[model samples]
Target: MKTTIAVLGAGSWGSVLASVLVQNGHQVRLWTRHPQQAAELNNQHTNQHYMGDYQYPPQLQTLTNLAAVLKNAEVVLFTVPTPAIRSVAEQVVPILHAQKACPLIVHASKGLEQQTHLRISEILTATIPAPYRQEIVALSGPSHAEEVARKDITLITAASTSLAAAQQVQRLFMNNYFRVYTNTDLIGVELGAAFKNVIALGAGALHGLGYGDDAKAALMTRGLAEISRLGVALGAQPLTFIGLSGVGDLIVTCTSIHSRNWRAGNQLGQGKKLTAVIKDMGMVIEGIKTCQSAYELARAQNIDMPITEAIYHVLYEQADIKQEITALMQREGKSESY
Candidate 1:
């Protein structure tokens, strides 16, 4: 069955997802705020700035008008950055409220709102009225846009409080190259999605600091511990931390050059300023902001996340990376079984 989908955001992830929808025979209308980006996607069928040399499916239409994109769409997927999710949700509220039937709201963003410390799904639930919303789903995993663009096999989890909603998204995106799984632990899935980025930043810094595999292994392992700790504290299932959105995302983002967060951390490890690293990346490095949010949340929850604390100090306090690492190592040793 063919469905009309409205994809908000025209970046690499958004364009790649819209292309996937088109390939799946859905009517995909991607929304972009920039006129030039919209024109490029509409006329040239390319989003050169994000997905270099990767031509989008011509069936994928790009538009600047949100109303037109949302018109008769059965699903509205948001691929915007974490910071923009709330604002975009606010913008979609009035338009969605006017529709006779509420569309399933799905978000692929993988970070928490900084100040409020709310997950993407929570933000959507708070902003979108109940009458205008059917279900909120989070689509996340280790999948990267570049790899997906190359038709590499990608598996992601579609998490919702409603199993039916998760199954719906699974059917929508599953194909030859893309695979989807359903998980009902919405809290666990969202936390795993958001917190893994913080661990990835630390993993990249370990590489940047000339650490060997032993050190990287230690950072990643302990980082997973921190992720699981904070995640469980926030009502996430313990098992979800070992699944795709948790350890899976951490492995890919920490080890791959394709990750903007890892790349930014590498620059920071090379002694570059955070501002310069972010400016040069030409994209949002979500972990930097997410680290702060996680640090604050961990403190509030009384969860001890030493790795997150170390990375937070390095990124926010301008602490020397080496010094932070030393500080981490010098902390009182405890049994790993804790």
Candidate 2:
């Protein structure tokens, strides 16, 4: 069945998703804050700045007016960064309130709000009213926008408290090259999606510092342990960590050159300042902010996350990365299955 979809944001992921939805035979209106971006995407059918020469489907519409984009939309998919989700949701609230029927709300963003530490769905629920906020779903997994743009064989999980809602998203996004699975563990999916970015940052740092595969393998293995611990503490299912959003996302984000988070960490590992790295990347490295939120959450919950703690210090406290690694290595060892 065809759907009228409103895709928020014009970043690489957002643009690629809009293109995919167009390919899926949906009426996709991609909303961007900048008029120039909208005009370029609409007229040129390409987003060269972010997507790097990939041609978007000409059917994909780009718009600056939020109200216009939301008009008669059946699904509102937010592809904005975590920090911008609330602001965008606040804008969508009044428009949605005027509508007769509520659209299915879905988000591809993966990060916790800095202060509240809320997931994207929680932020949507808090900002959007009950009528418009029904059946919120999170679309996540080891998906890189560049690869997905090339029609790579990508598998992801669409998670929601409502199984039907998850299935709906699964149907909307699933294709021959892109597959979607439904998972009921919303908390686990969101946590796995967010926490893995932090781990990917660490993995990139390891690479930038010239650490071999053994070091990265150790970091990834133990990083999954840390993610699973905090995730379970926050009420996520244990098995979800090993699923697509958890281990799968972690591996791709940490290893792939397409990952902004991993690239940011690599720059940081090479002794560049965080500000410089972020500025140079020209994209949102979610792990930078997520590392802070996760660090605070872990500390408050009394969760033992040495890798997170180490990354947090390196990013925020101006601590020497080498020294932090030394401290981590010097800590008393314990059984792998604690």
Determine the C-alpha RMSD for candidate 2 after optimal superposition of all C-alphas.
0.8
- Per-residue CA lDDT of model 2 for 172-268, tens digit only, reads 9889999999999999999999999999999899889999999999999999999999999999999999999999999999999999989988888
User: Model 1 segments beyond 4 Å from truth?
Assistant: none
Give the top-scoring candidate (lDDT): 2
Weakest 10 consecutive residues, lDDT, candidate 1?
93-102
Model 2 C-alpha lDDT versus the unseen true structure: 0.93
Compose the digit string of candidate 1's lDDT tens values, residues 199-245. 88887888888888998889889999998999999998999989998
Error of 1 at 74 (Å): 0.5
